[model samples]
Target: GESVGLHLPTLSVQEGDNSIINCAYSNSASDYFIWYKQESGKGPQFIIDIRSNMDKRQGQRVTVLLNKTVKHLSLQIAATQPGDSAVYFCAENSREGAQKLVFGQGTRLTINP
Candidate 1:
């Protein structure tokens, strides 16, 4: 079965510092990647996304990178803030098959004052 996992379970960054979260997916066939931010007691919210055809995509204060060669995906957040504290997840989807998205285990991002 295809699965996704985070390189680290948790990441800590000082306020105003940049933060990076990494995820590796087993599905080489994945064609789309999305980064989601999940706050406590709330559903995941879309942050950024990239397609296999592109190497990187940027959104407001955030970026998503895809490395198809390594089946790796990463999310970068600029200027970490208290509001950025949450669990981040990377999800992959392949258009070739049943149209399902596989989510990574998620990484807890802690923002320090």
Candidate 2:
């Protein structure tokens, strides 16, 4: 089954720094990967994504590196700041009939002065 809790709260971080968020998935055959950043009371915005076929993909100040060899995924934020403060999430979609998505523990990013 997929991994996620009923009420797992997000994480927090400071401003002007790099942040590393980790995620653990249940399915070993997940084919697609996506990262989303959601603000207070807003929809999750797409940050970056990768596929099971490849290993790493980078964009803007954010970099997504996938380690399918161990079913692990990570997101790296460079020079994080006030605007970068938000909830970060990692999701994996299995290559099945329905192709459902599995979410992981969300991290709440907080910027500091």
Candidate 3:
């Protein structure tokens, strides 16, 4: 299924701690996936992306894991910070026309002092 709208949940973590955000996608044929971080009043910023052919990919202080068997994806952030607090979202590249990114429900990450 394609996601036209999203309802994000909330996740709270302490500073200096690691935070893990999980997302589920309905399209098994989606070959590409991306993780984005959206700050207040700003657009979504790209963090990392993984292809369906791969199981894992890593970037600066960030990691993305894809599980095709279960249709699950996760992003791992190292050392949570106040600036890292934002709404995280996962998007799946559509296989149909235009190949637009279909975003899943996001997760709000809150860092406590």
Candidate 3 segments exceeding 4 Å error: 3-8, 96-98
Best lDDT goes to which candidate?
1
Candidate 2, overall lDDT? 0.78
- How well is each residue in 1-113 modelled by candidate 3, as lDDT tens digits? 46522334899999999999998887767889999999999999999999888999999999999888988889999998899999999999956567589887789999999
Compared with the true structure, model 1 gives a TM-score of: 0.95
Candidate 1 lDDT by residue in tens digits, 1-113: 88999999999999999999999999888898889899999999988888899998888999888888898899999999899999999998987657578899999999889
Give a tens-digit lDDT track for model 2, residues 1-113: 66732123554567767878877676776889889899989998989999988888889998888887767788889888788888888888876677576777688767776
Query: How many backbone clashes are present in model 1?
Result: 0
C-alpha lDDT values of all predictions? 0.91, 0.78, 0.87
Give the winner by TM-score.
1
List residue ranges in candidate 2 displaced over 4 A.
Answer: 4-12, 96-99
How far is 9's C-alpha from truth in model 1 (Å)?
0.7
Residue 83, model 1: lDDT of: 97
Angstrom error of the Cα, residue 94, model 1: value is: 0.9
- TM-score of each predicted structure versus truth: 0.95, 0.85, 0.90
Sort the predicted structures by TM-score, highest score first: 1, 3, 2
